[model samples]
Target: MSKKALYIRHKAQPGKREEVKRIWEKYARAYIEDADGQIAYVYGFDDTDPDAIVAYQFYDGEAGKEDFVKQPWYPDYERETAALLAGPSEFRTITPQWIKGGAA
Candidate 1:
């Protein structure tokens, strides 16, 4: 089966870029240990805007993506970070058309 990917674009509230990065790092560590369906998680700050951050998570497949959303920590993560966000996060689910070099 083909892998699935989730893309998230987040804008941090004023002066919250560092906090957002720290929280995301904590979340990534937890996800690495416990996310069964996740293949990888990548995150970074936007090039043009330091307050904007982007994250991507690769899954085994669409079902894996579904399973991820159902995980107990999902809602908690969303709620915990919601207050630090300048607005709602932009989310997108994508199918990999081509991949090269790296494992992703």
Candidate 2:
């Protein structure tokens, strides 16, 4: 099966960008690094929007993505992240058609 990818765009509450980042690091960064079937993960700020948080993730397949989100800790992550977000997040699923260097 083809790899599954996700693009997430989030707007943090005013002046909460750093806090959002901190929470992500606490909840997800190391987890993604060691997850089975996860190909890559990227988290960073938008170049044009200081309050925007952007993330890209690549997984071996849809199930890999699902497994990641189905963890027991996911709800805690959701609740915390939601509190710092200004509004709903934007999520997009992608199927890769080309190869590139690994995520940094």
Predictions in order: lDDT: 0.79, 0.87
- The C-alpha RMSD of each candidate to the native structure, in angstroms, is 2.5, 2.8
lDDT by residue for model 2 over 1-104, one digit each (tens)?
Answer: 67888999999998899999988888888788889878878899999998999999888888778987888888888899999999999999998877686432
Off by over 4 Å in 2: 101-104
Q: How many Å off is the CA of 36 in candidate 1?
A: 4.2
Counting only residues 3 or more apart in sequence or on different chains, how many pairs clash (N, Cα, C under 3 Å) in candidate 2?
0
lDDT, candidate 1, 2-57, per-residue tens = 78889999999987988877876665557655777777778888989978999898
Query: CA shift at 101, candidate 1, in angstroms?
Result: 5.3
Best by lDDT: 2
After superposing candidate 1 on the true structure, give the runs of residues whose Cα lies further than 4 Å from its correct spot: 33-36, 101-104
